[model samples]
Target chain A: MLDKDIKKNESADNFVLRLFVAGASANSARAISNIRSICELYLKNRYELEIVDVYQQPLLAQQEQLIALPLLIKKNPLPERRMFGDMSDLKKVLKGLGINEVI
Target chain B: MDYSAKNKSKLNVLPKTPTGISGLDDITRGGLPQGRPTLICGGAGSGKTLMSLEFIINGATKYNEPGVFMAFEEKTEELILNVASLGFDLASLIKSKKVSLDYVYVDRNDMEETGQFDLDGVFIRLGYAIDQIGAKRVVLDTIENLFSDLTNESIVRAELRRLFQWLKDKGVTAIITGEKGDKLLTRRGLEEYVSDCVIFLDHRIVNQISTRLLRVVKYRGSTHGTNEYPFLIDSDGISVLPVTSLHMDDVATSERISTGITSLDSMLGGKGFFRGSSILISGTAGTGKTNIAATFASSICDRGEKCIYFSFEESANQIVRNMRSIGLDLQKHIDAGLLEICATRPTMFGLEMHLVDMHKKVTEIKPDAVIIDPITNLVTVGSVNDVKSMLIRLIDFLQRGQITVLFTALTINKSVAEQTYEAISSLVDAWLLLRDIEFNGERNRGVYLMKSRGMKHSNQIREFIITDNGLDLVDVYLGPDGVLTGSAREAQILKEHTGDVLKGYQKTRKDREILRKKKILEATILTLKAEFESVEEELNRTYTEELLTRNILEKNRKEITNIRGTSSENNTEENGPHIET
Candidate 1:
């Protein structure tokens, strides 16, 4: 019973995120920076974020059926969410993540 | 010679537009500058207009870059319809905003009557068209048509410089076509120095054969092909090939295609020529040079591969009919789009134009193989050096594309099948010699492979014949008479008769000797049998004598035994009396 509670706590603290970028274009670089800033400002202590360069790892990107670049995918915490665009708007991103409200 | 521009960064330069022509890109390394003026100069009927139109149409439709064509000579409708035969839909392209056609309408007659002229009006009209459609490419067809012969040379020179500068400043790739003269590059030589690139097109006839050629006279800031190339102009447009003259490693094929003759194929490593290679069939008139070339071409086309036949000495219909008489019908292939026939007299135009025409046709047809029925007919119009250079360029262009090119030459000597001139021999990859050999009261046609690159061909001459079906190369008739010379064959026949007579005499003598040996052996057997019978009789007589002597002795011994028994009985009775005493 103690082990189950510990596992739940660990799951809540760890977060898995992935992004698919088609090319080394200008927009792709901007999206990468914005996502990194959002994670550090609000969820730094509560969750862990992983950045993946899809151009370098095309095979993995293909496995996720990625069609365009600058795509953010929330892989952890059941019912995964995906957002595609410049990734600058934090409100729409939080809504996509099921946050219900932006802190 | 100039390195001052090297310090400037080139990272901001735009990517070049691909021309998409076969060998042009390879020669230019990629394509022409994306947004720069390129000058194309040539003489009358030298394909300047055709080449310019091809560039513009290709850029617009093929590359999706809008282009504007301003012809100072041909009308808009004539130019459009002319290129339409090449499968270029200029009308549709213009309607869709991809291409624009305009005619500058420059007439020397009008200029002579007016006595005053300026090219400013021409530039204004061209610039307006370019601006209206946002065209990235522009063509000035035959710019020389705008000039009058009596115009001041200094003014012409200045105007050319300004024209090139303005086009460059506009940042659009423009082609300014010119008319070549006997001495000067153009009526005015100013364009050659002012343009970043200068291309020269030539049309010449040699030995009644017309050829078209293209050469890069000058190219700044880049290396290009320096050799003259054969080109062709037909309904498909203009194509320039630098040929295989570029010094680079060429891959040779080991797999061979059948020559359609069993004996010939077996002699050539059990196959035939490499998939793509040039073959030279040379022989004197009536020595079957055309027959061999036609047979090879027809056989290749029969295999479902496309072939192009350029007959400089005969008409297309005539060649087809003549070949049909020999049982090779090429009309079926022509209808199937597998065989294309292009016939023309070399003297009808310049030798360089003939080359260009061939290049153009080959590109449009995209044939796997090409045949020049007799290249010798083309030698009449130019000097030996000119013909050699043109032929070299032609071969070079075909080799680069890996297109199999076959050329026929008429040798001087009836016995010799290849040209001993040494001009074209060194450049050819393979040479097939067809000769007439006289033997046995008849002149026989012998075919042999003199040399084939990367192939093991027969060194012996084989008798070849053209039959109802096609060429049939017979086996080498190596007889005991040493190559079957007339006198040697007769001597061999006489020697064979003598040999039979001598063999009969030896058999008779051997038969007599065997009969004599058989009689002697039979006599010896008879004597041995008699001696055995005599020995048997003597043994039997001796045995009978011994039997008689033994019988008498046995009778005497029986009487002695009976007397001994009586004595024993008497002794037994006496023994009892002695014991009592």
Candidate 2:
């Protein structure tokens, strides 16, 4: 069933991303702003993003096996990918997310 | 600063948290720095994980302090299963909320690094676990995994520094384990970040026998043992032997205890070994070293006190059966809980492990006496010096508890035996040497006190005999040639006894002959006296008769001459005739 959902999301070209961060930290804020702008400019309205604060949901951080802050996990992509850091390097972030060209 | 005030402040400036592992706290001098991180670095399979887990478990169980264990290499279940053999029920500790386990599975294959990142997630998770259990201790076992999981070395290093600072700020005593490097203490130099304390564990095989050693490399504010101490890992977990007591001021007692052989006791000041003293019984093979050790053990048990016998040469049943032949009923003492026989091959473990095992047993049983039968077998596992050092530690431990210990050592060669005893004899209070007295084409056992400190002991070597009744020490015969033993001594005694009887008989016969000669001499003197008296009587009668004849002749003549009252001349003539007759 999870595979079917991922396939359906992939057919519709919907981008699902989960970003784990510590609450209100400078790195978390920078990562949030950087990814928001990149997603708006590149995927437009075709992407869905969920921001989770590990401070508020520490068990979620353990479940995700998170070691670094501002970790991004792409959910709906056929091949899931994880990226660590504040998402400041746009080229590396875009490459990790499988985005080829600028919008 | 005033000196007194400075000393007062220094007394407790570094409050330590006690690690409940045996002997570790002793060497660490009350354990690791409190509320600070201690880095434990060692090579692979060197018991890094096991030692850290024991720290957490000991904290949670013994100190009543909750702890968190975060594993970077092993998962939580694997970590639990790994320590199960040590009798640590991690799952139960977790259920009771005394411990929390977190496995940070970081696989480099599944993640990519885009830019700058920090370890806030690890911090939050660790903080959450600590808060959940109010933990005062934490363990991040081999956080060096981060260096492998991440491509950025600078980030991992920086984050580790921050993590250590965070752990310190949170006020929890933590242990961070790392893999040893070729040149540095840790592969990633984790020791640089956790600077409050550093411990090094090493596992090395010497002479095909592997020994685990632990060393406290540095303690920031406290003095710790700097020597590399041998540690043991068994069902009870890791035990680091301090190897030597810092002080040699153990109180000596004047009380004495029996050595189970009455005549042997007579050799040793007519009492026995001093209480709480180490006694060494050394001899060649088949010289009844084990028999003497068993006798000591039985003597202890006979006093209704507990005794533990550690046999490296024989099994428990074999020792029991063998001892029974010499009238030592060890099984009854064992059944009565006064005696415990622990038999293990010397090759089964390193010398340190055997020492730790004996230490643990002594601690558990609190015995009054201990016996190590044939400690020479331990030479198979370690060098003579190694055995000596191990025995030094063992004796120190047993002496501190005021327990008398008897050690039996087998002498292989004369020179080596002397060398071995020369190394260990000084450490003991009394030394009993058993040797084979080879004389008259027979090998007889002889025992002599090489030295008994603070006592007047016999210098004579007694003939040692093991009979159906028990062990006995007979005074060896000093013969014309030399010391006599076995049948030669008996024969010499018999010869002297017979000679005494023959000498007495000859003296009596000579005395009787002299008495018979004296009686014959007395009879001859009496007969000679009788003959002499008879002859004198005959002479007197003849003289008297002659005088009477002269008188009769004179009377007749006088009568013829007128009644011959004649003249003075005639009377003169008659008197002259009588005198001539």
Candidate 3:
């Protein structure tokens, strides 16, 4: 799944992502696994991932303007994009971040 | 189909969390529904947020349950600072991990999410705040801030419902405050989503006095007080007063007190008032209401028991000074620590706030007697219904503590029909009425026992007077005409005294005249008797001489007969002449 905005501004090829969680919530755990599977299947050796526990780093969450939980933010893929919820829809999550196919 | 039984079988029994508020817990039977969201909806400055925070703080401190406070409006520091005066040390609580405060700033201009956005952002913040503190209680204060300037109402509404359900799923009792609306409990009508329990707070101005009230609109699975109770926000924080819970079944006492007047006590079945009973003295202006109240309060103090006087009309010093004129020194009791005078204006707060203050003072002082000087002034703060409700609560509370309560009400008219709010009169155990009886171009004070439950009282009207020595009650003058009092009674008594004196003088004059006439007649009769006796003595001497002459004649007749005849004739003539006279 490719996004036109990402295609136009392809300044970064590697993906930098941040996942926000609150104490191993079901959505947080599921979103964590979904992000891991998506990275392994599509971006593999090209992605860097970081998971933030808002319960521990609430100041960080506030500074980042995080409003929703289990949120996935793609930071290093040209333009940043955000997706909310458990990130279960692979195609939707990939398109939201402006990624094309599996590599 | 046995639907009733079937429904009962499926019905869920909800547990409660005591709010630790004074009257609230008793009214709620326990507290808010546990592990569920309770909605607190009210207008601005109605103590909604304060009450919500108090619930959480009390849970942490008193119930050993940690709490989380999430705000969509106020910042954490601002919230902390605002509550600092209420004796809530939020910062310390946070430091001790007993409380976690989170603020989610949802600025309308900045919150224009372009794509799919769930409220999970604030949700996660709140969830984290709760998890970090292991909070059993959660408070989302004024979450309506999220709906401000938002184009998406449906989504926001759904998110709020989901958030509440999620809190319930997490098994944390939560409080959600919402803004009151024109025709709905909440601005968005969120009362539908908050189904477990709904508390509505109301703040309004009546007769130019602001009053805050609380009502439990709905409470599932348990019975709750349904009246609109007055809630107060002061140094101690917000407290809901459960008014109108009239538990009239308290045991009646046989012990009595003086009615503050000796004659008045005799009127009240030879006693003053029953212990734990409520006495209401109602009168118009200048009927010695304050004097009676002062006497009652002073008497309680004199008994070595504490007395609290809520004087709406006079300050403590003013009462002390004024009562001195009547020869009652109340300051001595105050100095001795047996009396406390709380002088507050009736307009200072609403009715329920007054009740809450009284409750607080009573609990703090543990007074044996309480006097509210002129409770009718409370009508200025609220409607008749509100005042009645407040009085009921006060009477119930004081009775529960077995405190003898005396209340004075200033009335426009002394007639029962003219009393604007007589509901309080009905609630009292004894009622003493002080009236100004205008007669003979003079106004006089009269005291009458209107009613005293469970005790016999005098039906006669007694003249009530406040002298320099104290209260004095004199028997009303019941001349053949009607009852007389004051100067008229004095004049009647004076008139009767003059009439009695005049009658006694007339009776003595008549007795003297009779004695003088009798002496005159007795003197005349004695003179007449002396004259007659003299005549008779002369005649008897004559008769004896004649007899001697006759004897000589008779002897001489044997010797000289002619001499006898002449002597006898002369003697007879003398005797006859005496008899004739």
Query: Which candidate achieves the best TM-score against the true structure?
Result: 2
The alpha-carbon lDDT assigned to residue B168 of candidate 2 equals: 96
Clash number for candidate 1: 39
What local lDDT score does residue B478 receive in model 3, on the 0 to 100 scale? Answer: 98
TM-scores for every candidate against the unseen true structure: 0.59, 0.88, 0.78
Regions of model 1 farther than 4 Å from truth:
A1-103, B1-32, B44-47, B70-127, B140-166, B177-193, B202-213, B269-271, B281-372, B381-408, B414-422, B428-432, B447-449, B452-458, B461-481, B485-581
Q: How large is the i-RMS for each model, in angstroms?
A: 28.3, 0.9, 5.0
* CAPRI rating of model 2: medium
Better of 1 and 3 by TM-score: 3
Per-residue lDDT tens digits for candidate 1, residues A3-63, read 3533454574355556555455565677677777777775676554555555455445324
- Once fitted onto the true fold, the runs of candidate 3 whose alpha carbons sit more than 4 angstroms away are A1-59, A62-65, A69-103, B1-13, B107-114, B117-120, B148-162, B383-386, B413-417, B421-425, B529-581
Model 1 TM-score on a 0 to 1 scale: 0.59
Model 3, A2-93: lDDT tens digits are 24443444457777777777767776788888889988888788777778787777666656656656677776664567666678777778
Mark the regions of model 2 whose C-alpha exceeds 4 Å error after superposition: A1-12, A99-103, B1-12, B515-581
lDDT tens readout by residue for model 1, B1-581: 14646644444543465666656666666667667777778778887887888888888878877888977688889988888788888898889888878765532221211111223434555666677678889887766654553244555565567777888888888888887866877766646544567778887654555577778776667777877766766555655666546454566566577665677788788888776678888766677777777777778888999889898878878878888877988888888888888888777777666766787777678887899978877666666666677778777777667778888888775322233335687778788888777777766677888888887777888777778777777754567644643344445667878989999999988897888788777777778877877787788777876775565445445544554756655545444333321
- Ten-residue stretch with the least lDDT total in model 3 chain B: B107-116
lDDT head-to-head 2 vs 3, winner: 2
* Full-model lDDT for every candidate: 0.69, 0.89, 0.82
Report the lDDT of model 1 for residue B42. 79
After superposing all C-alphas onto the true structure, candidate 1 shows an RMSD in angstroms of 28.4
